[model samples]
Structure formats: C-alpha cells, structure tokens
Target chain A: MNAADVLDGGVLDAARALRERRVSVADLVAESLGRINAISGLNAYVDVFGDQALSLAQAHQTMLDCGYDLGPLHGIPVSLKDNVDMAGVVTTAGSAILKDNVPVADASVVSALKRAGAIVVGKNNMHEFAWGGTTANPHYGTAGNAWDASRSPAGSSGGSASAVAARTVFASIGTDTGGSVRNPAALNGVSGIRPTIGRVSNGGVFPLAWTLDTVGPIAKSSQDCAVVLQAVAGHDPRDLQTSAEPVPDYLAELERPLAGIRIGWIHDYSVKDVQPAVRTAFEAATATFESLGAIVTAVAIPDLDAIVDALVVLDAAEPSALHGRWLRERGDEYGPDVRAQLEAGFVLSAVDYVQAQRYRTHIRARFAEAFRAVDAILTPTLPFTAPRIGQDVIDIGGRDRDVHTANMQFTALASVPGLPALNVPMGFDAGGLPTGLQIITPAFEEGRALRLGHRFQMATTFHLKAPPR
Target chain B: MDETDSIRCRLRAHGIRETEAAVGLAASWLRNAARVRAVVEEVVGPAAGPVTAFTHVPAGLHGEERRERR
Candidate 1:
C-alpha cells in the first residue's frame, strides 16, 4: 500500500500491515510530517520534531526487520500535547513564560508510548496553561478545527484533536483537567477518553488542578483509543497519585456487545439550555443505544449545578496556587484571560476551597448511588457545537451564555467525581460541525465506557466521516 | 470594608497588582464563590470529609486495607 492509504487507515490496521511488511515505519513518519507541513494553516502543531521522528522511525523499522515486534503501537506515529515533557524539548504548556522550561527526562506517559514503539512526531498546541477551553494560544497562534478552520476546536486539547481529525497522525495524547481532551474530540469528530483520575500518571506534565487533572488519548476511533490506552494506562511510581489497580485489557473489552448494559440518561441537567442541534444529536444517540439492546433509564442529578459550581472553585483555586509565585513576579507575561483567571482565584476564600472539596465527596457519593442502578451514564459532551474562533458569547436556548462556562457544564459532571468519560462522534449539526456523546462509567471501569462507545461506532458511520480537505 | 475592597486587599496582600476593572471582576467572582460555598454547606454534613484529606495509611495499603477497615 502507498503512504496515503496507510495514513488513512486505522492504527490497528497499520499495525497489522507493519508486521506483514506491507508498509515501512519511515514512510508513515514521512507522510505524517508532510501532511503536517502541508496544512500549516491549521496550526495543529506547536513543534514538529521532524529529524528525531525520522530517526526513531528508522530504528523501529530495524527492530521489526530483526523479528522484534514491540506491540500494537509499534511503528505508529503520534503527537503529544505541548504541556507534556519530551526530554531535551521545551515543555511550553502553551505559555510564553515557560519557553525555557525544558526537562531532561520524558514524562511517564511519553516513556510508556516510547516503550510501546510509538514514534513521537511533535507537540500539539494548547490553551495557555490549560486555563481555558479555547486553544487560541497567544504565543503559538490559535489551533483551528479540522472541519472548519474558522471555528474553534473546543480546546484546551484543540491541537491534539485537530491533528487526529486531519489525519496528521494516528493518535495524540492530551491532558484533561476540565474536559480538555473530550471537548476538542467532540468538536473535531474524533474519539477521546479521560480515564478515571489516577489511571494514568501525571509525572512530568504541567499541573492545572492537582486533583482534577488526567492524561488521556485522542484518536480517530474508539478501537484506536483502546490501543493507545492499553499502552499508557498503568501505575507509575513517579506519580504518587496514580492508582495501584492493575490496568485491564481495554482492547479485549471493545468488541463486547452492549446487551443488558444499563445506561443512565441525565434527564434534567444534561438537556437544559442546550442548542437544538446538540439536543437532537444526543437524542438520536440515545435511540441508537436503545436499538442496540441496551436498557436506557432516566436518572436525575439534582445537585448538578452545585457540583459544577464547586468544580469552578477548585479548578480556579488550584491553578492559581500553582502559579501564585509567577503571577506575582511575572504576571504581565500571561495572556489576558489566564491572568484574569489567576487573579480571580486569589479572591476565593479558604472556606470556598474547603467547601468545594467537601462538595466533591458529596457528588461522588451521589454518583455512586446512581451507579448502583445503572452501568454507565450518557450525556452530550458539550451543550453547543463549535463556535466561531474568538467568539466568547454563544446563544443557547434563546439566551446568551458564556462559551467558557457552557462548555464545562456537562463535562464537569464526570470530572468532579473523577469518573472515566469517553467522547464519541454522534452526528453533525446543521453547520456540518460534529457533535459528540459522552459515556461516563464508574471509577476504574473505563472498559465499560469504551465498550459502549465501540459498539456505537460499529453501528454508525459518524466516526468514519472525515473533514473536507 | 466592602467586598470589592476586601478582594482588592487580598490581591494586594498577594502582591498581585491589577487595574480597577480587573479588581471589580475578581470581586464578582468572589460573590459567586460565596454563593457556591453556601450551597455546598447546606448539603454537606458536619461529619462529611473533604476529598483532599491526607491519610495516615501508606499508599499501598490505602486501597484494600482502608476499605476493609471502613
């Protein structure tokens, strides 16, 4: 097969071809680099490690030639969000202030990817310090959506989703503090997973909220995400917060049918004030799941608003504490939005922070109660489709809502309780932009979410839809 | 002092200088935080614990043994 055909195929397909000697790793890397360069206007990449990627590709090819196959991800090309550390490379975290912050060692996730024989193509751009959802970085230019360059990718992992959607690489890793990974994945028509917090190590990655932050995978398909997750989801001694629970066979779980699985539909909170198109897509997804023999039940999360407010408190306060010294010393260097957010964090009282933590326990207990009757919960990833690139206010249900707050409403439901959530492409809006469905499962039950998502993708063609070139 | 003044003082205490407009925004955020805290306090019991608590048990034993004790 030619380079384009191989690049267009899924990661597992590429893995099969590699073992059969149908494609060379060097050609795949070259095609990925060429594609990234060809669509420079997308601004999906912050730094393309062309030389190093090619060298590693050649090395992997030699390993395969010597009958030493690494694994499913062997010889696959993937990108990392700029916030993740790659030794000898600057981990900018999409901020001008951290331009000189280079680590001598790779982050634990990066090391795991390397060990699986995945070649690191480059670093994708992100929102500054991941403080906001839009990937409009002041220092690294705004990353555009693959479907429409003029629209937002619903960041902070915008660039990673864009690359995956544009087929620049097989997959990319992104950090999600508050729906960063899943948000962009929805907007860009891809699949992304935020494993339960502590499922993946946070070592060498920059902090947003110490407790809320998680590293996750964004890819073209749920199966591809499973392949990537299998390589990276495990405990690391370097990150003390990582779970000691053994990582399950995620790929093995993907082919299971959704028969008899109970999915909870948040009747009130998830559907409130959502755009009509998003609501329609979510309803269709619900119907599709029912058609697959899965039982759907209406579940209410009455205190969802309070839980989101608590999320706001913790998300704001933790990042501010992390950047407290810098905000005082070099406050002028940060972008206007992030700087303003950091300043707002200072005004939150100690009582506010402590109450938010207490509220987290309450919300988790509520979800645990809900989970006793349901195996998983389904909701829309975002309340609206991707807005225009730089637009702050969006109309939802005839009222203007702030884009930053609206984007986090449904996403925070899972983030606050540290549950595993998956974003899968459901369908397109009238504007042809993609809308996503979120599947959330209990802690350490990422397999459930992936299984539901995989079954949905198998029965639908939404995930196979590529952006207009 | 009024809430805005209190917020401005807190900002100054942290040595973070900002314009009056920015300080006003911060004050608004603080008001919202106050409302959130009240809502949380209404639902959370006196015996309820925060999620960020430190444990005396080691990391390895915190999972199984802690659950057993509970």
Candidate 2:
C-alpha cells in the first residue's frame, strides 16, 4: 500500500492493517520518513530517526511473525515533541544551547510507547523551551501550518500537531504546560488531549512548569489519542508527581453513548471575546451535542478571567526557575522571546508566585462547584483560528489583542485546575482554517472528555478532513 | 532611573545582560506579572494557604520509623 493510503486511516485503522499483515512495520516507517522529507518545508521535525526507526520496526515485525502482539499501537509510526527524550538522540527542546544534549535512557513515556510497539520516527519542532505559543523556532526553522503554509500551527506543540495533520505520523506526543498540546492541535485541525495533570508521567521530559506540565497525544481522532494515552498513562517511580489513581480504559470509554450527558457551555466568559467565526463554530458544536442527546446548558465560571491571569505568573515564575542558571550564564544562546520571558521570571517576587498558587486553589474550587452541575464544560479551544506566521497581534472583535494572551484565554481555564481537556475539530471558517471545540472535564476524568470528543468525531467528519495537499 | 532602567538593573543583578530592546520587553512582562499578582492578592485571603505539594515519602521513611531511628 502507498504511504498515503496506509496513514490516511489513522492509528486504529493502520493497526487493523498491521494485524492482518496487509502492511509491514517497515513499510509504515519508510512511508512516514518519506512524508517527513516530502513536507520538509513545514519544518515539522527537528531530527528524523530514519535508520533507528526502521531497525526497531523490523524487530516489531519479527515479533508479530512469532505470534507476539504488543496491543493496539503495535508497529504504528508516531513522533515526539523535541522536549521528549529518546535514548541516544539529541533532545534540543527546540533551542540552540541544548543542540548537543543527548539522553542515555528514554523518557518514561517514550519507554511506554516503545513497549506498546509504537515507532518513534522523529522529534517535532517546538517553541524554544515551550515559552511561547507559536512554533516559530529561532534555532530550528519555524513550523508552518498544514492547512496554510503562511499560517502558524499554534504551538509549542506545533510540529507535533502539524505532522499529525499532514499525515506524517499516526499520532505525536506533545507536552502541555499551558495549552501547548491542545492549542496546536486545534489550529492544525486534529484531535488532541491534555490528560489531567499526573495522568501521564513526566519523567525525562524537560520541564516548562512543573505544576502544570503534562504529556498528551495529538492525533487525527479522539480514539487514536485514546490508544496513545492508554500506552503512556501510568505511574512512574521517576516522576513523584504522577498520580497513583488507576488508569481507566480510555478506549473502552470512547464507546460510551453521549445520551443524557450533561455538557456545560461556558457562555459568558468563553464566548465574550472570540472571533465571529469561532463563536459560530462553537454554537454549532453545542447544537451538535444537544442533537446527540447531550443536555447542553450555559454554565458560568465567574473566576475564569482571573484564573487565566494568575496562570501567567506561574508559567513565568516556574520556568524561570528552571532556566535561571542557563539564563544567567549562557543567556545569549537563547531565543529572544524565551530569554525575555526568562528575564521576566527573574523579576517576579516570591510573593507573586505564592499569590498565584493561592489563586490556583481558589479557582480550582470554583471549577469544582461548576462541575457539580455538569459532566463536562465546552468552549472554543482558541479565541481565534491559526494566525499568520510571525504575526504577534491579532484583531478580535475590532480590538487588537496580543496573540499569546488570546491563545491562552480558553486553554488556561483547564490548565489552572489541571483538568483534562480535549480539543476536537468542529468546523472550518470561510478562509478554510479550522475551529476547535474544547471539552473540559473534572480532574482525573479524562475518559469523560474523550467519550464526548469520540462521539463528536463519530457524528462529524471534521476530524477526518485533511488539509489540501 | 525609570522603570525600564530599574528592570534593567534587576536583570543585571540576576547576572543577565541584554540589549535595550530586550530590557524593555522584560519591563513590560514584569508589569504584566505585577498586575496579575495584584488581581490574585485581591481575591485570595491570607487564610488561604499556597497550593503546594510535598514530595511523597516512602512508607517506612517517616513518622514512627524515623522517630525510632533518631
């Protein structure tokens, strides 16, 4: 089978083909490498593990021949964000300073993916140190949107989402500190999930913000994300923050019916500042839920705006602490945007960080209160669709707003409370850019979010739609 | 000195030297952080403790065992 034909069906479909011996693991790896090279202009990858991937694929193929199966993701080709470590590979975190940094052992998540028989083809490009939303890497080239080359694939998981949208891989692991995974997934017109904090281990993954950092999967559909999540979600002794809660059967949960599910639409705060097209798409998604027998209602989150603001302090301070030594000794090697943010972090007083943490507790209680009336809350993933590459400011409702702040508005709502949020493509605007509907569930209730997203994908073809090649 | 200079001095105190333009950017970020801090302090009372988690100690490392060892 041709590469396009093999990858077009996504992880589960490809898994079926693999089990039936229609395509060998080597074939999938070769096709993924070819596609990565073909779309080299997108800058979707920082380093391609061509030979190493093929060798691993052959070993997996050998296992299959010997009547051994490693489960659903067996032999599936996927990529990892640059910040995720793969043994012997340079984990640059999309920065120049760490270009030569190599790990002796795989990240716990990488080991999990390997144990599940998933092939790691390459490392996706990201915003340097994940301090920014745009994947306009100053060290590695900027990653372009799969839908429109001149537009951004909202980042720091830009390349991961772009590669998935472009069908270079079945799925890619992207980390979220403040909506890094879901934001890019939304802009790239794919399905991505930020598993509740601690649902997946963060061992060996470079830190952005310790409290909010999470590893998640971006794929063509929620079911595919579930498969990836199933492989990676579990306790790791290396990561003390990882949850001891049992990892639920996410794939099994996807089969659950959407009937009678209480879906809350955060109408006031979520819809107040969105672009017209995004708002329209959000309404349509809400209506689709209602049609699916979900009881959709307006839910108010009074502290939403304040929580978003407080997140900035934590995002700035925590990462600054991690990068303090580097910023002080070798600051010039850092990208301008990341360096400035790190400098800003140094200026924040300890009281500011403490206040932000207190605010996190305050806002989490508010979310818990709202969750009492609803199973999940819905909002537009971003206030606007993917902006033009290199554009820092965007016009929303006739007022120009900073792109970074606008991108995080809806995403931070989930991040502040470490809630599980899924970004599912709803529809496209007139310009053909996709709009995403975000489903935020209570902490450790990622299955609810996945079930809602999977049902939405089953009812609509938005997640299945590919960008024009 | 102005706010930008004040921030530049702070950055220097942290051993980071940047150009004038970068310092200005850092100043804006500092102002933004300050604004967020103010909003958070307004809503969060002193009675509310910071959201912090202590690292998990092993089963036998604490309490009676540690007391017995001492």
lDDT of each: 0.88, 0.86
lDDT of 1 by residue, B1-70 (tens): 9877788888888787865655766776666677667777677788877764222222322233223221
Highest-DockQ candidate: 1
lDDT of 1 by residue, A1-469 (tens): 8777888879989998888888899999999999999879988999999999999999999999998899989999999999999999999999999999999999999999999999999999999999999999999999999999999998899999999999999999999988999999999999999988889999999999998999999999888999999999888999888888888888888877788888899878767789999999999999999999999999976667676677788898999899989988898899988898898888887888888888887788787777766788899999999999999999998999989888988899888888889999999999899999999887777887888999999999999999998
Give candidate 1 regions above 4 Å deviation: B52-70
Q: What fraction of the native interface does candidate 2 get right in terms of contacts?
A: 0.35
Which 10-residue window in model 2 chain A sums to the lowest lDDT?
A301-310
In lDDT terms, which candidate is top? 1
Task: Report the CAPRI category for model 2.
Answer: incorrect
Please report the TM-score between candidate 2 and the true structure: 0.95
lDDT, candidate 2, equals 0.86
